[model samples]
Target: MAKITYVNADGDSTIIDVANGDSVMRGAVLNGVKGIVAQCGGGASCGTCHVYVDPENTKPLADMHRVEDELLYFTACERKENSRLSCQLPVSEELDGLVVHLPEKQL
Candidate 1:
């Protein structure tokens, strides 16, 4: 399992373990990690799972794809250079220490 850290807007953080092949959003939802709504259930269309990947850890994440890119435009919070949909980030052993920052809202 890969360990991922999720930091909320209020600065509270939780670390969850995710199995390989599972998306970051899945780990959060299953663990009850606050901040990621994941209303579309990992489908990439909802933008509800939007997160700001810690800049230092992004190298291990998948590159932004068209679907995520377009949906980001509809996020409920301000988009940043590190903005990404957690559902699009698959867990892997290489990403064991991945850290992502949750946006203020996901609607």
Candidate 2:
């Protein structure tokens, strides 16, 4: 299992042990972490699962796809260079210890 750290909007952090192949959003929601609504479930259609990948670990994620890029534009929270839809990020051994900073709001 990979340990993922989620930093909430209030600067509180929650660490979860995620099984490989699980989406980051799934892990966060399963653990009942606040700040991640994931309103569209794991589908990329909604920007509710938006999260910012820590800059130091941003290079490993797959490049953003067109649909994800478009939905990101509509996110209620500000988007950053490392903004990503949590559902789009699959957990892996390489992603162990991955840290994501949640936006202030999801809607």
Candidate 3:
């Protein structure tokens, strides 16, 4: 399992053990971590699962796809260079220390 930390806008954080091969959004939703709406349920259609990856350690994460890159533009919060759609980021051992911050809100 990979240790994935989810930090809300207020700075409150939750650490969840996400199984390898699972998307970050799935880990958050299954464990009841607040903040991610996942409106499209991993379909990458809704921007509700948008998150900012840990800038310090994003090298292990997957490259953004056409769909996710476009969806980030529609997120409730303004997009950042580290912005990513959680559903598109599949967890792996290399991402054990991944930290993702939840936007202020997911509409």
> What are the lDDT scores of the predictions, listed in order?
0.92, 0.91, 0.92
lDDT of 3 at 39: 88
Model 3 weakest lDDT span, ten residues long: 54-63
lDDT of 3 by residue, 1-107 (tens): 89999999999999999999999999999999999999889999999999998778754778889999998898999999999999999998888989999999889
lDDT of 2 by residue, 1-107 (tens): 78999999889999999998998999999999998999989889989999999888843676688999999999999878889999999988888889999999998
List the candidate 1 regions with Cα displacement exceeding 4 Å. Answer: none
Candidate 1 lDDT over 3-92, as tens digits, reads 999999999999999999999999999999989899889998899999999988745778889989999999999988899999999999
Error of 2 at 21 (Å): 0.9
lDDT (Cα, 0-100) at 8 in candidate 3 = 93
Clash number for each model: 0, 0, 0
Query: Candidate 2: misplaced stretches above 4 Å?
Result: none
- Candidate 3, residue 38: the lDDT equals 94
Model 2 scores worst on lDDT over the 10 consecutive residues at: 55-64
